[model samples]
Target: MVDQSHSFYLTSSLQQKLSKLVLAAFCLFTLYFWPQRFELWLIQVVIAVAICSYFSYTIYRLKSYKSSFTLHSRNLFKFANNPNEFECKVLWVSPLLCAFYVLPNTEVEDQAGKSQLIIVWRDMLSDSNFRHLSRLLLYIRRNQASG
Candidate 1:
């Protein structure tokens, strides 16, 4: 029988997305103005600093995540080097390309502070596994709303 529960490892999609976003920001910023606009150099520098900050955050998240997440019938659990399993709630669900975005339940309005997980469908062992995970998440979400 197919297991209702499964573990998902962090994928490289996160890194790729962050890098692409950084590149896009630089491209957009440069394209917004002409090369002769020397007075607006300050704006370019400010945006560059913002991009650098995002790059640093990306690196930190990638380095700190040394674990996988186990999704069960009722709750999602994270296993890392810390030993103690961390429980998480589904803050949001969306299919981005072939992957799913998940956020831990938090009261904070900003999603950046919440732990996020991206599960890539193509990275799964089989199609059935991916389907099962999807159903499980849907079930849990429904249960949360009813109870």
Candidate 2:
């Protein structure tokens, strides 16, 4: 069985649908504009490379930390709690505007006996941010005196 203390929430169906719509719009725009300019093509290629690098790094970091959570699930939880909470603080990492934030959500019970804390973000936090957030959560969890 999966570790209950490390469980991550799942994204809602509506949020998933909205994400697809936004992705479609972005792809349409890219397709329309990408072929028009040689300079734009170069810029787009550079941007694509940067984005890929970011994602690769993020994924590597996430794997190293063994994160069970995903961006979609985090966003869904955030939306359910307070849709406006992410208006200013969140940052999108994907072309489709997949967001990243440091917002808190409801504690969830995993298949195991322990409870899990949730942190929502677009992709994942930076290395420093991740460390800080983890430390903060550890402190909180310790003080809470409950798993």
What lDDT score goes with residue 89 in model 2? 23
Cα lDDT tens digits, model 2, 117-144, are 3334323444454444343344433433
**Where's the lowest-lDDT run of ten residues in candidate 2?**
70-79
In terms of lDDT, model 2 sits at 0.39
Best by the lDDT measure: 1
Error of 1 at 141 (Å): 0.3
Question: Candidate 2 — number of clashing residue pairs?
Answer: 4
Model 1 pairs whose backbones collide: none
Give TM per candidate: 0.52, 0.28
